[model samples]
Target: MADAQRRIAELLARCDLEEAQHRLGELVFDAARQAMPRNLPELAQLAGLRKVPEMFPGATPTARIQAAIDTLSLAGGGTLVLDGRILEVTDTIQLRAGVTIDGGWGGFRAAPGFRGESVVAMRRRRIDYDAAGYARATNLLNLVIDCNRQSGVGGLCHGNAQKDRVDGLRIRNCLADGWVVDGGYELFGQNFEVIAASRRDGGVAPAPGRRGLVVAASDCHFADGVLQHFPIGLHAPGAHNHFARLHAWSTYYAADPPLLIGFLDEGEGNTFMACSADSPRLADNAAPPGRENGGYGFRSGGNAINQRLIACTVQLSQYGDAASLPPPRTIIPVHCGQVRATILGLEVRDYGSAGFGPFVTTPSPAVMRETTILGGNVHEGLPTNLQLPWSEPGRFLPRLCIAGSDAGIVQARQFGAVTRIGGLAVFELSLCLGGLRAGRGAVTIQGLPDAAAAPDEGHRIGFQPVLSHWKGGEPVVAVLHGGGRELHLLRQSTGAPVTGADLTETTAISVAGQYFTDMPGDA
Candidate 1:
């Protein structure tokens, strides 16, 4: 094509007008012949290619792009290729199934400025659901949607029968929310960056956008994304979704509601692996009425069950001039509510003031049960590592009960060693009584920690005797009554202290029970 055009230009320059005109006609005919398919197979491949600028010349860029999209959709799904032009979209561009819009994104020249090839400067509208309320198997690749404070991408309605799914959706730079999925299923999104509008404008004021990515669907998979400057970077209230290598960060400036959270997870069976929630540049700001000023790295609540966070990190960067600024509010790294969860290899760091700990569990009437923190490190500088409502009386205490082994007894020799359940401490004890003799109608077990004692002297710690080789007259039940290192055992059935006469010299008894102690666990 270039050679033909160059030859025509040379011919016209040499004052050969007739020959130049004939050569232009021949070039046009050859171009038309190549566009027209020679065979059925060639026709099928050519039919799927629709270039926006070439197909709808003289039309507005938005109209041209939408016409190409509609034309490809009408042809039973095809690729709508943009000519690397910036399209100003003032109305919602409805997407259809089996159509892939390839907006030849040539990288952001000035990122967050929304300047680049194949960019859609959405004025106030969004690329949302079609008239049927869902668009399935629709893909978007190498596109940049400058939402201009409006929505970037929205999907299926709440009660839609068909699932709205986008496979292989890639946005290099998004000015607002990257996408919002409602009632979507099995959607795959990757390699996107969503930045808040305020950050893009270099403003200290709050960004009008709420979340970078909002997932209200199930079985969706998102990976390798950067979400920055949104109040909540990822608000996933969907179940069975997997997010990997996604990093969410807040800007230095504060928002109206305060730059609060990184990831707000209220979904069941959601897994976040190798993700990070960081507050690297949080400026001074007053929190909400009753809430704390600082933000949370990741918060899980609202009846969420079976959520797993594997090898995730939550960090708060240290301020350089700490004395100049007011102390940071309670910034909880990971806050889990009354839900069943497993946190493995979670790294939490706070280089600033000591606010809250790395792990915090809320005290509710429905206590958090079946929670496990396998291996994690809460670095120094925090006030306390594991903060739980341990003083909430019976409501929250017994929920973190520590059960014993196959014999239902944690050996008393391992008493000082902390046993954690959901990062809270619950100590179990099993004392072997063999050579110890009963004196003054009571057998005092020595070497027991003071935490093994009852809360008060009047409160007796109950115990059941596991008799292995009882000669005769072995006490079946007993209670420890003390507040010191010595645990004095008294027969519970008789309300009298166990005497040596009741037990033969060859008798063996193992006292086993669990107790709630004030000692904190290594969470």
Candidate 2:
């Protein structure tokens, strides 16, 4: 066993990333098969998997499970079978490498005796990396985790100097609730399911930043999951992750603005493939409005850059019972700010109140510069301002916003889609679109007139422009405006706008976008 384990380690050290994940997945499954009671006739079966049985004196499932894990780790790693006996977790047991928690979903019960804070966690550690057959291998083959308590699995990465880096982790067939995960590198989550999520002790509304999953690790993958009943379905605060065939439904309400997939805080270079996030709130339990009131289907917050959503659909509505009515006047299915978003085969629909704002909206043309939208449908389900003249643009906002900026310029290309932008007087246009800072920066047609009509037309317009770039200043007012086009200078607060006699059209421009240099092709 020792020789074989060492050989596997050597193989891992040599194989490239994809090959390593494939090899380790097979190895862990093989180990699990070998450890099942069917192979060891001495052990009894529970819930169709080998049962480790309760330990003496301390018969709690947590204690027995820990003891079994310790035993398995000391003698190399193997599978730990669970019967789902409603274990109440007071402390989290860190999983070791090469250990697979097999088949817990079949018998796991919730709402009766489940009292765990967070069922388990596996941090990136040297022991995991160096252990001959420890958990750096694929762990948790079939776990049904219920954080009846308040905590997320894979809590913030544990590393020196707080560098969040993780590698060599795999969790599959996990059906969990509460806050699900904070992700890790080289991590693969397959066949995962979450029916609901919250920090609610019993009822809802007390959930604190609750979500089904939060991916904060790069090079990680999550595929084939149905997540529902959470404020935010998946929040990616880290970069370079991939998600496929993920469905989030039955949205809950939150003033923080619920989103199906949200990439925020400078998280860049992520991909969503064949992903769909929508509210079944219209269908679930007769559509009493089921919580997730008006909000964005997918939104990119400040600094979120270079993301691709391919073959993705985001359908949201603010429809709910009177108790669930949203306060906002409109809802946006997709909003992108300061992002080089590449959207292909995208579908966005808004069916309820909180009138549909935009299929994809960005406040600054410079923010979504280099954006490309190809082959998609943006439907508001009614005669919307999308049809009205730009004059009545206040009735409904643009389907796409490419308002330019200060630090740089804006660039966007639409292969096939209905997008609108109006009121082009913007010198450096930026709009604080909504209630939350996370969802602000809406460019309005009513704006830009201030810049176009400014008295000084030589220098950049402090008034809003189609260009919305930032130069490390608050209320960033610098304009990337230079063309034979006249420049408008000064703000309403500072002097008057002036026209330059020798202003030359800009032949060269610097860009601010960080990601999506190469657009994502297909799922």
Candidate 3:
């Protein structure tokens, strides 16, 4: 009721009351016809469309739609084309086996090549087909799945417990995700696919375990879209899957890592094109990754097994004392794998403990691939390095951290100890900032060179700061490298893991802060 009232108010505020009332009348009339058979005959009277087709001269499109639904309910395998501007189901209607539902494309308004409508406004869908039935549809635009009054769980899109395939659809702005996967014990779908889709701005997270496009199978593709504030965006647990050209941000925790593939699988061909990682914390907690403050980029702690990550980008926002984390310090606790990573055109800065090296890997053995750490930035902490109490053979490619203000390029060893680094390159001395403080937590980067000779040494990299501070004295020339990239900033004491609540709080603060300035997660 609140939502309806809100929409009504929005219309009234944006449009003339007379026009709003007319649209509302049409919606009510459409709803009546679908729920009441006696009302079906009157659908034509309300819409002014003839009941008889000019050729058939017998029944209208509205009648045909009803006839199809009714006949299919009996004949079993029929296609229903619904043309009324509004089709509301006040009651539950089970669509039996091999049925197809065809709704208006409004001239491809809700699809690609045409940006007609992004929102699908329709009424409830208790429309049941056998959980194991096979059904298909295309172009479900501005269809509202209002279950607020009908079912306790109000959602925009709903499906059967078993196998179902929905393709070439665009569903936007509803009570929830454009398409929803219902929760039931039944194990459905031997194979299901949703290709070329888009979902944007819906209500807040739909309960505890839901997402923009939630699936539980072996094959699913959620390609292309601008999804925001969707709690669990693009969540799929089935293995042997592929995710390409998918962009997501401001989601509490996206693409549940291990579940997307398997705990022991590889993520080689997957590409997270220009995605942003923001604070996930919503409230306060004492744990490092708690909801205590509710600001976070991701909560990918599940399957930390053998997984290969390639061609992905991550950008994080920081605040307060944590604003000075070092390079590589920002990307930490990497699991075990013969992972081939290339860090081209990357930026890491602003946090207390910038980077923590090679987190504890799984018992399974893994190798480091040709990791190119070039054209990047780092801040605050030491060239943080950390090695597993039990691990070996750490390697990289095009090994380099550019020199610049707020770019901390530390030797891998200083952060932690590792068996070996394949290619090491420090283009120039990056300008780094501060380190962690007391009570938060602490990290230690060991094995980096304390000092080096010109050109070859860590200090002689390039772009020495006009001023710097080490212990209580004057600043010195923090040597830069060959290329004018990377910053050699002051290091601080290591801090503990961040608490979840703190993250949330920080993120909220940042968001609120952005409204006053520039939005934080715009890209």
Candidate of highest lDDT = 1
Q: In candidate 1, residue 340 scores what lDDT?
A: 74
Q: Write the per-residue lDDT of candidate 1 for residues 1-523, one digit (tens) a residue.
A: 5565577667756767656545533443222111111223222332333321233234433444455455445545566544343455545555655566565662112223322222332111123445674554566666555544433332111222123333333442333445577664777778777665553345343344357778887888889888776667788888889999999875444332234577778888899999998763233334421122335777777656788889998776644344222245456666666467777787767756554332445544244345666555535543333334332432221110111101111111111222544323333444222122222233444434335434544445455655544433445554434443334545556666554445443334454445555455344
lDDT of 2 by residue, 203-285 (tens): 33324345666766677677887666655667777777788888876534442223423322236877889887774222122
TM-score for candidate 2: 0.55
Clashes of each: 1, 52, 101
Ranking by lDDT: 1, 2, 3
Report lDDT (CA) for all predictions: 0.50, 0.42, 0.30
Model 1 weakest 10-residue run by lDDT? 399-408
Error of 1 at 313 (Å): 0.7
User: What is the TM-score of candidate 3?
Assistant: 0.41
Q: Judge candidate 1 against the unseen true structure and give its global Cα lDDT, from 0 to 1.
A: 0.50
Report the C-alpha displacement of residue 19, candidate 3, in angstroms: 30
* Candidate number of the best TM-score: 1
Model 3 ranges with Cα > 4 A deviation = 1-70, 73-78, 88-97, 105-178, 182-210, 251-286, 290-310, 316-523
TM-score of 1: 0.57
Q: Which sections of candidate 1 miss by over 4 Å?
A: 1-58, 106-136, 149-176, 199-209, 252-258, 280-294, 319-329, 390-523
Candidate 3 per-residue lDDT over residues 244-286, each given as its tens digit: 4344444223321101111112232222333333322222223
